[model samples]
Target chain A: MKRVIFGSSWLPYAFLAPQILIVIIFFYLPAAEAVRASFYLENPFGGGSTFVGIDNYKDVLTDDNYVRVAKFTFWFSLLVTFFSLAIALLLAVKADTVLRGAKSYRILLMWVYAIAPPVAGLIGVLMFDQHVGPITDVAALFGYKMQIGVNYNDTAAAMIIISIWKQVPVNFIFFLSGLQSIPKAVREAAQIDCRSSWRRFWTVTFPMLAPTGFFLLIINITYALFDTFAVIDVVMKNEPGSNPMTLVYKVYLDGFRGSDLGGSSAQSVILMALVLLLTIFQFRMIERRVHYT
Target chain B: MMETTSSNLEVEARAGGRRTPLLSQRRFWRSVGDHTVLWLGVLFMLAPVLLAFLTSTHDAVTIHRDGLQFLPGDHFGETYEAVLFGATGFTGKATGLVMTFNSMVLGIGFAVGKIVISMMAAYAIVYFRIPFATLAFWVIFTTLLLPLEVRILPSYEIVQKMGLLNSYTGLILPLIASATGTFFFRQFFKSVPDELLEAARIDGAGPFKFFVDILVPMSKTMIAAIFIIMFVFGWNQYLWPTLITTDEGYYTLVRGIKQIIQVWVGANIPEYGQAMALAILAMLPPILVVVVFQRWFIKGLTESDK
Candidate 1:
């Protein structure tokens, strides 16, 4: 798009060769293979593959367990996106209000962003350890036993809590930036027009932050769907039930553990379609609001 | 808003002469409320890690028997030493130190590889006239939609066919061609002034020379920011490495920490202390990077979206 150009086409090709080769080999080739494999029954032992003509898709779509996992994934994504964004917005509002030690508060809150999801899971395990975890002991003090090992709901709750904890820093940073980006004059004008702080925030500030909120909504859902794989894996490692499986975890489980190549590939294709829709939505819908200012 | 409100309050206080005490009292209470909530938020975020750190210092038997320990224990050196240098009692493989080394290698390799390749691709797209360049960019951009989790099965097949299982090249190469980095670099390069390139051309510098001499130097901050993000991302990868590496020698710290817990079956106590220690160790580098490069990390997140 620039007016300036280097005319040597070979040089450009030479520069682009490594990236193009890697993308073709790693990304495009595998993606094409996944799409192809979704339509076929492939033997796990590398014997051969037979074209099944949508049978794989039919099986996956009809499976009750797959439907359950999809439902769980939907709720998990919703809870995580909502709580993380809400808590982060609250903290950002509080932090924005303070005139002293704001930098210290930001730094303290931001370090959690660096902790990986798996590591966060490990911390969650330690914090909610059935025998030695602090939270379990606290629950005991209240006469309510918190058994993550046996209870499916507890396991799900642990997964959601850890996911939200890990996600909060990123959301907090974005929300803080969003809060700061609102011009002071607009808030003052709203304050002069509206007497109550609640009304001012609801009318002027929250509407102004809608774009950031929507952007974080898409991002948080994407993250909970794909990035919390380790959290779920760690939390459910010792459990004897299949109730906590997210869709991505189901892909790994069905493909690798159960050795159902065609079924898992079909699931993968469906997941790919879902992600494709999310990506297109993010770019085509949310991008306009992102660049509005 | 804050300045205007405060100034207005001060004006009213001077006029009334008795509202000064009330105004100061409100300010005092507001600060107290602010600090209280901020500290509570900090505790909510940090208590888990703090508890993990405390648990890491205690002996395994004590932790299992006595529930949770509120205070630091004296076994810090012994537990960390064993966890870092000694193998798990069950598997006589590498220690957490080795896994940490493998993780460091993967993280650095992944970050540096993505930065180099993406910069070259971006330079080509932005600085030169090439055929199908827009198409190439879009093709790379579409890879963002196909995360490794979505295409795990065939990606594993591709790696298996290439005989890259359990190798560093297998670990890093497939994950390195990131669209985020390429898009980020392209946007950064597009923002570079046209006059600079024109001047460089007038001075008889070739594209390669100009790139190395001028553009790379100019992009140091962007590179640093991207490096922090990509390194943390690479270090935190779970599913890809779990599928690719079958050998214990290639186990990353993230995967190794999980293995430590998973391998302990039956009557074994699961070495909660060492696992906690390893978790802490795994978290150190990325946390350090974030604390040190806080500004760049923020810029990487906010700017890359744009």
Candidate 2:
């Protein structure tokens, strides 16, 4: 993109070799491997795999357990994406309005962004631990004995809550930055046009933040899908016995513990397609949003 | 003129007095509401950390007997000492200190390696009119579509076949294969002024000399920001490190979490305090980095989204 540039034959390639080499070995080779293995039934034992065209896909698609995991992943991503964005929007709006000590609030709120998903999940497990958790005690007060990792719904609830908690800081950071970027003149004009602050926000500010919202939506969905792998792993304690898990976890479980390489590869290919679609959708939206600005 | 202005202001003030107090009251309530919501959000973020840190200070038996602790217990010194200095995993090589060292290796190594390699590739792309440059960019760009999670199994297989298991290079290199760093540096390099390059060429500076003397110095802040972001990302990586490092000696703190859980599950009265301690240790560095370098951290994060 630079106007003035160096024109060299071999020097540029020399510089790019390390990166290209790593990408070939890691990204492209493994991606091709996933596609190739999806067509074969890899023997769990050391014996060689037999080529079974489309059979692995069929088994994974028809399996009741895989269906359940897929359904959970769908709903899990939806809930986390929705709630985190909403909570973050509210906090960002509030933080933007408050005049004093906004810096302190931001540092407090966004520090959690640094905590890894599994570490957050570990803390979640402790808080929801049936024997000694404060949350379990509170739930008992309401006569609802919260049994995380034992009851299916309770485990899902813990996963969703912790995932949201881990996610809000990033969303807050984006939303807060988005809110601050709104032009001062626009806010003043809206203030004159509408007397009520609530109505003014809906009319003026929300539309202005659409680009940020769309970007964050895609990000939140991706976070729920992939980043939560460790969170689910820690919460489920590596035991997926009827416990809810995202699609990524299912891939890990089937590949590593189940040792059903073909089936896992098929599921992984399915995930790859889903991510591709989401990314394409995101790019289109981004292009459109760019046009508006 | 001054008296007329003063009388006009006095009249306006007297007329608007009742309306002003009501508006002020509304604002007062609004401020209260805002502070209340923010405080609650802060507490939501703070409670888990506070509880985790507090629980770590107690003895394991106390934490086991009573769920988790709210206040510091008497075994603070002894517990941390044991977890830090004690070599006590099944493999007996996973001390807190060693895992921390491995985490530093992953974090610092990942940041440095990513920056160096990405700068080179980005420099080649942005500064040179090389053949197939666009094609190279696209190949790297498409990687953003398929995450490491999707290709994780096969990646593990390739790494295993290549005998990279339990090696730091295995843990770090595959992750740097992404185009994120290259994309970042390319955009940054494109933004550098053409006059600088023109001036350098006029001074007869070669490409490598110009890069080292001029571009690198100009990109100090950018490099620092990227380093912080990449360090946190590498330190927090769970899946790849989990898969690649089968040896306890190679375990980073983030991946050491699984070993901790396994030990807890096997133990009679799980080491709740030590588990919390390890979890806190895993979180401490990243949190400190983000909090301390708040501006640079936020800048790198939000800008990269674009």
lDDT: worst 10-residue window of model 2 chain B: B1-10
Error of 2 at A94 (Å): 0.8
Note the residue pairs that clash in candidate 1: none
- The Cα error of candidate 2 at residue B180, in Å, is 0.7
lDDT of 2 by residue, B1-306 (tens): 235434544454455566777765666667667777888888898999999999999977788888889998887787787778897442377899998999999999999999999899999989998788888888887887888999999999899999899999899999998988888988899889999999999999989888899999999888888888999999999999999988888988899887776666657888788888888889999999999999999988887662
Task: Supply the global lDDT for candidate 1.
Answer: 0.85
Model 1, stretches more than 4 Å misplaced? Answer: A44-46, A238-240, A290-292, B1-19, B265-267
Off by over 4 Å in 2: B1-19, B88-91
Interface RMSD (Å), every candidate:
2.7, 4.0
As a whole number from 0 to 100, the lDDT of residue B60 in candidate 1 is 83
The candidate that wins on lDDT is 2
Tens digit of per-residue lDDT, candidate 1, span A151-269? 87888899999999999999999989998999989878887899876677788888888888878888898899999998988887644375586999998888888889889889989
**DockQ of prediction 2:** 0.62
Candidate 2's C-alpha lDDT?
0.88
